[model samples]
Target: MAGRALLVFLALTILSSSVLLPKARGNSEGDALNALRRSLTDPDNVLQSWDPNLVNPCTWFHITCNRDNHVTRVDLGNSNLSGHLVPELGKLEHLQYLELYKNNIQGTIPAELGNLKSLISLDLYNNNISGTIPPSLGNLKSLTRLNDNQLHGPIPRVLAGISSLKVV
Candidate 1:
């Protein structure tokens, strides 16, 4: 009976681990998003609902999540926000659209953003952003539109190979 109980305990532990793993990873995404929330200055309180204590960002306004609760879109355009973008933004593994246009945000784009392999549209247009675009952006095979930011410096040569890319 002792051996049987031990086997059951181990099985339960393994089962629980499988369930807990995604929640932990999901929380990391929430943490990453919250990190971004802390970095910006929301003068209009548009991001007022981005409460980090929440179980996940899916409940937050302007943030869209997939069926699995993975964050997919972050729409903060034209909301009178300022401050620089954070590297934690790259941790949104499932993110597709990142729209931060028409804000007063200033500073160099974090090259870590290139880690977003699933990004489709990245519109930082009409912002006060500066600095060279990361060459690692070429890793975003799913990228379709990246345009109209205040970015300077010669475009990375690797982007020329991505046929799906349009507009910059």
Candidate 2:
């Protein structure tokens, strides 16, 4: 009888952990996206679907996720979004494309963006963004675009090291 009870307890523990583990991982990405939602002034309500109470940001509009539910892209270009970018965006480890062009977004690029090892394209052109481009962006090995923003200061020499880079 005791053996049966022990088996049941173990099964319950495993079951609960399996269910909660995914939510825990999704929460990090969701929390990061929610931070961005809070920072932006979405006049068009493009971010209306960004509800933090949801299980994950994968269900949110403008956010793309992989099979594992990790955010892989953020397609918010020309959506009339304004407001400075939050550093919390750097938490998206699988982010590939960050399209926020043609908006009124201001403030300097967060240096923490260098943490996105999987980033491919980072489009922030035609915005009101100002300040020196963060040199840490040099860390993106697959970056294709880094142009047309209001940034000043000598382009980071490190960016020249990346062969995938097209326009800087």
Q: Whose lDDT is greatest here?
A: 2
> Residue pairs in steric clash, candidate 2?
none
Runs in model 1 deviating more than 4 A are 1-26
Structural similarity to truth (TM-score) of each candidate: 0.85, 0.86
Model 1 is weakest, by summed lDDT over 10 consecutive residues, at 19-28
Tens-place lDDT per residue, model 2, 1-168, is 999999999999999888766644449889988888888999898999999998888988999999999999999999998999889989999999999998889999999999999999999998999999888999999999988988888999999988999988
lDDT of 1: 0.88
lDDT of 1 by residue, 1-168 (tens): 999999999999999888766654448888998888888998789988988888789999999999999999999999999998999998898999999989988998888888998899888989999998999888889888878877888999988987899898
Cα lDDT, all candidates:
0.88, 0.91
| Model 2 CA lDDT for position 119 | 96
